[model samples]
Target: MPELTTRIGDLTMRSPVMLASGTVGYGPEYEGVIDFGATGAIVTKTITVEPREGNAPPRLVETPGGLLNAIGLENVGLERFLAEKLPEAAPLPVPIVASVAGTGAGQFAQLAAAVGERDEVAAIELNISCPNVERPRNPVWSDPVAVGEIVSAAREATGKTLSLKLSPNTSDILSVAEAAERAGADALTVANTLPGMRIDIERRRPALGNVTGGLSGRALMPVNLALVWKVAEHVSIPVIGSGGIGDTGDALEFLAAGAVAVQVGTALFATPEAPSEIADGLRNYMEENGFASIDELVGMAREERRTCAETA
Candidate 1:
């Protein structure tokens, strides 16, 4: 059997397939439906300092190739997550990556510290790409300076693995990514979701209550692959490719593009068993390709192409 285990900083994942934040709820909800051990890690929904009710109804809508959502980071808050959610998640077979979001740097630092103190938590994924909030006047991921500040604050607060989730809406994502790495990020989640909107022609109103939402699904695969390739080339830290991964092939594309791991999001809506299935497929692919470990496959495409060009 091929070695599927992967490491991000001090944390190690059994597999490179993680459940994307917000897609799998907090963890307990998918208990019977999916086998936790088959996955690398479970990233909880984005949690805030205080409980949030989220946006009004019509927050989710289906588009031609993706799902648009404006969930507004509805969560049970830090208190409930640690007291209620984390305890339930602690016993799961995989490591728990707490996904957190805050309107400001201080809040992010506080949230990171609280979650990092827990033994059950293996890493922290900062959701800085949320489109529903506008508290900073500018999105955190849009500005390299802001990204560095938030990442630096969180780095000071936690000794655990810290992964900053970037946004595709930025003008130059590479600059923002480099900023986070310099600020001490342990890993980088290649992206969150892209800005999108829908309209109900009949009603002559927006399909989502928030008017604009974040897009995720099959359509995002290519976009995220490019990001993983770009960031992986520039940063030394592991990159977790997220966006639209629906199967083993999609996941492999990310690994080939230099991502150490892949996060499955919108696919869960249609195939709750997608993660395990992809894991199985990944193993099969490795065995067939004579790969003894996943490390051999990570960024193989780039290396092979470079070699070809050098010889040519």
Candidate 2:
């Protein structure tokens, strides 16, 4: 069998497929639904310093090719997560990546220091790009300078792998990505979700209670894939692509685009077995194609593009 091992900085995963944050609740919500063994790691819902009630009702709207959500990072507070959720997740065979967001850079450092001290947690994913919040302050990932400050502070506070989850809603994504890398980010999650809204003609109002929401699913593939390719090429850190990955083909596309790993999100809402199915498909494909490991498949498209460019 081919080796499916993938490395995101010093953190090594058994497979390249990971369950995205917010999709799976604190790890117990999907008990009988999906097999945890199929995935390399699982990122808990984005936890904050305090428990969040989240946005108003009607937090989700089904769009044509995607799902719009304004869930607002509803999660257990830091204390509860560390005291309860983390221990509950410790029994799972896979690695646990704690997804966290703070009101500011200092809070991020504090949260990282607390979470990183736990033995059960394998890595820290900074959700600095979430667009669903009410915005008492500007999002950290929106500005390159703030991104640097937050990432730097968190890096200093944690010894575990730090993956900066970036946003695509910015003017220059490349600059933001470079800034995170310079601030000591071990890895980068290419993106979160696109800001979009659907109008309710019948109600003469917005479909989501939050008025605006983040879009996910197949529709996000093209744009996010391009971003993953660009950011992966520009930064030296590992890139974990998260967007519209629904199947093996979608995951393969992200890997080819230069992502070291792919996070399965919206797919889990409907097809809970997607991560395992995709992982199986990837293994079969690698065996058939004579590729020994995920590293060989990563960035194949970029290398092809480079060769084509040189030839042209």
Candidate 3:
């Protein structure tokens, strides 16, 4: 069998397919619905310093090919997560990557230190790109300097492997990615959901209560794939691609494009077992194609492109 093990810094994942944050609701929600051992990791919902009520009703609106969500980072506070949520997730077979978002560098550092200390948490993902909340300061992922500051602060606070979840909303994602790499991020989760909205024509109001929400699903795959490719080309750290991935083919595309791993989010809403199924498919594909490991498949598309350009 082809080796499915994937490593991001010091952390190792059994498979390249992981459950994206906010989709699986920690690790216990899908106990019977999906196989936890099949996936590489589980990124829990974005936790804040305090518990959030989240946006008002109508938090989700289905578009033609994607889901627009304004969940507003609703999650249990750090204390509860450590005491309750983390303990509940203890039985999960894979590593637990705690996702966190905060208002500033200090807050991010605080959250990172708090969660990074827990034995249940294997890694820390700094969610600096959540679109639902309104903040007085600019979004951290948009500015390279801010990205450096936030990532650096979190980096200092955590001994655990740190992955920075970036945003696609910015103009120059490569610069931001490079900044994160320089700031000591172990890995980068390329490109979060795109900002979008829909209108309820009858009511003449926005479909989502938050007016604007992040767009995610099949529609986001191509866009994020390009970002992953570009960012991977520009950075040395591993990149974990996330956006729209429903099956093995989608996962393969991201891996070939230069991602070490792929995260499945919106697809879980429709197929809870997608990560496991995709992992199996990946193994089957590698075996049939004679690929030795996931590393051999990673960045194949980029290599092909480089070869073509050289020949041309």
Where does the lowest 10-residue lDDT sum fall in candidate 3? Answer: 303-312
Error of 1 at 221 (Å): 0.9
Candidate 1 Cα RMSD (Å)? 1.8
Candidate 3 lDDT over residue span 1-312, tens digit each: 799999988789889998999999988988988788899999999999999989997999998889999999999888899999999998878899999998888999999999999989899999999999996456677889988999999999989999999999988898899889999999999879999999999999999999999999999999999999899888989999998999999999999999999999999999988988999999999999888899988997887755864586
After superposition, which runs of candidate 2 have C-alpha atoms over 4 Å from their true positions? 136-138, 304-312
Q: Over the stretch 181-229, how does candidate 1's per-residue lDDT look in tens digits?
A: 9999999998899989999999999999999999999988898889899
lDDT of 2: 0.91
Q: Give the C-alpha miss distance for residue 234 in model 3, angstroms.
A: 0.3
| Model 3: residues with Cα > 4 Å off, grouped in runs | 304-312
* Shift in Å, residue 78, candidate 1: 0.8
Residue range 1-312, candidate 2, lDDT tens digits: 999999987679999999999998888778778799989999999999999999997999998889999999898899999999999988987899999999889999999999999999899999988899966555667789988999999999988899999998887998889999999999999889999999999999999999999999989988899999899889888999999899999999999999999999999988999999999999999999888999988997887755864686
lDDT, candidate 2, residue 146? 88
Displacement of residue 163 (Cα, Å) in model 2 is 0.1
Task: List the pairs of residues colliding in candidate 1.
Answer: none
Q: In model 3, what lDDT does residue 243 have?
A: 89
